[model samples]
Target: MEYDPTLPWYRRLHWQVLSAMILGLGVGWAFGLPAANAIGWIGELFMKLLRMIIVPLVLTSIVSGVASVGGGRAIGRLFGKTMGYYVLSSMLAALTGLLMVNLIRPGQNADMGAAAQQEVPELSTPDSAVDLILDIVPNNFFAAASAGDMLAIIFFCIVFGAAITGLPEKPRVVVTDIFNAFFQAMMALTSGIIKFLPIGVFALITKMVGETGFDRFAALAKYFATIGSGLTIHLFITMPLLLIVLGRIKPLVHFANLREPLLTAFSTSSSGATLPVTIKTLREKVGVSNKVSSFVLPMGATVNMDGTAIFECAGALFIAQVLGVDLTIGQQAIVVLTALLASIGAAAVPSAGVVVIFIVLNAIGLGDNPEAITIVGAMLAIDRPLDMYRTAVNVFSDSCGAAIIARSEGEEGVDTEVRH
Candidate 1:
């Protein structure tokens, strides 16, 4: 993580993005409304570029990756390994958050009485398990892709890829090559789009800072700090340790290779939005095969949300403290499970973590309080900065899982890339 004297500063994409962010913050703070009016479109353009290729990249990558996984046994084996890593990582994150909130006790002496005027959003109840099941099998394939039902698209892609593997050898090679070719083309487009990242980060950060100044942080700094601290520990400590112990890869080398997607995730605050960069970075820079990054990352973007699990767990506990409701040991345990499971089918759920906090609160019988709702409303107003941080953690966890799983699967040079 030190300065590489051999590599020129201007050549480092991460540092360029960081510099853009700092400059954008100053521009936004100084110009306010004018800043947003002038430069917001650039950021929007950047997002559109990132999003434009997602459906195709995901479709081709998974189809190609899964189809090339060798056989049915390999597909299932990789599935089990990926899901196991995802579950274990998210569970650990929930535990870390649970411990952090209890230690910090940020909501203990808080004043929420005057926050009645903040606009509270309606509670977003997550769908039942059966509804999630129904969402997976799309009634219409192209319709689902057009509607951006990633869960449906993912399920279909998986089945389609598996079917390809079962085809006669001559036809199977033809289909796999077609998909592999498409995936490479999409990746080239992704690389072109990523070259504009610094500009996009600058504009996006500028717009955000211009619109919402620092005044919002006046209240609920403690809650923000709570989430921040918990995420920091999980990001730098929990995940790296897991990588070292489980993946047997050099964490620093892995980290250096992943700067683009991490910075992209932070600026965008959307794991799905930053996925093309994630996939491309893993393939070209981190040396993860399309076989693992392709399969693991898309699903991870939707299903494995370690950061969201931590945020929801800490958020629910913080809300409980604000309401003076001391959760029982059993209730706290329920929070842990809910937070972990709530992230399962998140692609189909809008604001999956934010809306689902009520699910956690209601699990502990605190759902119907008028004052608590207002506090939640108030908290929503100041959540963007923390949202950005946690989104980065989410992306990082996905990358870590890819690297670890790739290493476990015996992908040589995985996380050992030294691209300058």
Candidate 2:
């Protein structure tokens, strides 16, 4: 937690990460896919290490956080606010994407029919909404944790953590202390892993740039522009406004503190993979308390997917445009509703959005079209970069939720003072 005052800025973590990104971009551009593929293992190792800690970190953090609050009412209040914020933010994000895609018309007048010749990636559609609700209660808690089923883990932790509050005082104190200790230990472990972040970012970004090069982007120029512009606006303009206005926080200061996690999220392109870093940064750097961060952040990873919602709505509309199918207003409303629900259930992994996007397509009557399949196949070619952008947005939104919720809970320092 301490820094050497004498160390030059160039040796600092933020500067190091920035330098890694620049160097990675240069190397990837010069060497291309072979270099990217060769060096990818370094990034993968970092991701593995991050993922290794997530389940335990989430379990202990949520348990400890809820127990520390000492009652179900406090935890319930937090949950209500957190979920309300997520729904509102997701609606805005999806609406923004819907509006942007309509204005840009990326698929209008395009000859993307040849996409039919490409093979579509196999994807498993999520079960019915009721089934998704049922799945939140795992058949076995240990199995859910081992499989890293976030929603199931969250449900179990909330129940277990709440139960701890109702125990006799002596046992409640004992149990709470144990979970708190475990959470702290996990944070310490995460801090050690975070030291390798710059190297991991360098490798991951290099591989991404090298493998997909710039030429492919030109082919999907308008599609990329629409999604990219929408994401940028949502992340930089919309979220910051929400923080400053609603949360009473300094958006720039919070953003400065978030650089490490955001970079890691972009590189890994999986919020679940980056959850440890996100929780660590929010608590250590952004000055959010463990109570708020532990509860808000883990839940955010599972359901507060502003970026995925945006991508889902826009991507569905894009495919429709390419196929020359105009959806009615009622149908677009279905896209919005389905996108929100689909994003909540979407796996927090790179390109996972594409897999569930078919739900939106199917809802709008385009799911069975060969032309729709063709466009999806074509879109897959450039999904990685877009995935990275949206993942960063996803992480950023989660952090914002934590900070806001912390402030609402009367936790100070985040809105009034800068941590770093």
Candidate 3:
């Protein structure tokens, strides 16, 4: 990649986004709600643009890339490894949170009072395991696409891509060429949106800081520390170990390659919004093939969710502790199980984990507790920063999975150099 000689050094995207964050903090701190409201539209536009590209990108990228993987056995092997990694990573993440929160006991010895009744959204938790499985197969592609049903979309794309290989040579070539071209075009468009990302980040951070202020941070310091600590362990420790042990790759080198995607995830606070960046970084910087990245990264965004799993587990435990509810070992096990499943269906957006935390609480039989509602409400106020942190973890985990899978498949694109 070449830089424009005439452009100032600070005009670079990384520097520019960093500068925007600083300025956004100033605006939010000094001007407060008025400025945030004024600049919020750009943030909304930025997210919309990112979301707009996801469906087509995933559809084309997965369909084209999977079509290239070839044959029934190859597809089966790839699918098995991908899902095996996802489930393992997710469960480990949940367990990490469960253990950390139990150890830290952030909500223990706390002086939490009854909060004024806030209207919580009605949660539609998955009815059964069978329902979740059946939901993956969409009744109508158009409806699924419009709804942004990622699982259904992925399911359709896998079947569609697999069928392409069975077609006659002429038709297979034509179809592959078409989807490949479309996927490339979508990526180009995503790159364009990424250019304006700094401004979007500025707007988002400004709005959040301006409206919420920092008071909640002081109030929820322990809970914040607990969540942050768990995320840190998972991102910096557990995930790197996975890469080193299972993938047999250099964890530090892989971490170095993830700079852009991790930073983007933090600023955007939405894995879905940061999907374009994650895909690009994995392919271009980390040296993963489009085949592995296209399949693994998107699925990770929709399903893997290491960060969200941690939050659900920890957050549920925190709320329970605050409510003076001492859950049994079986109930704690239920928390782990529920968190792992709830995270799979979590919306890949900011604070979505907290929104669904009630499901975990409900699973462990604490949903109807009045104090639980109060605790969750208080936690929600301080959720923005945690959301940012966990979103980055979510992206980091996805990138790691892509790198590991690509290595296992013997794709030669990983840049193992650790930049100073």
How many clashes in each candidate?
0, 0, 1
lDDT string, candidate 2, 127-181, tens digits = 7988888889999999999888899999999999999999999999999999999
lDDT by residue for model 1 (94-181), tens:
9988999999997988766543234655543336888878878999999999977788889999999999999999999999999999
Q: Score every model by TM-score.
A: 0.95, 0.96, 0.94
lDDT (10s digit) by residue, model 3, range 107-135: 88765553222345554546677988999
**lDDT score, candidate 1:** 0.86
What is the model-wide C-alpha lDDT for candidate 2? 0.87
How big is the positional error of residue 166 in model 3, measured in Å on the Cα after superposition?
A: 0.8
Model 3 alpha-carbon drift over 4 Å, by segment: 1-11, 114-119, 418-420
lDDT of 3 at 183: 92
RMSD, every candidate, angstroms: 2.4, 1.8, 2.2
Question: Candidate 1 — number of clashing residue pairs?
Answer: 0
- Model 2 regions lying over 4 Å from their true place: 1-6, 113-120, 123-125
In angstroms, the error of model 1 at 277 is 0.4
State the lDDT at 39 in candidate 1. 99
Rank order (by TM-score, best first): 2, 1, 3
Ranked by TM-score, the better of candidates 2 and 3 is: 2
Per-residue lDDT, model 1, residue 23, is 96
What overall lDDT goes with each candidate model? Answer: 0.86, 0.87, 0.86
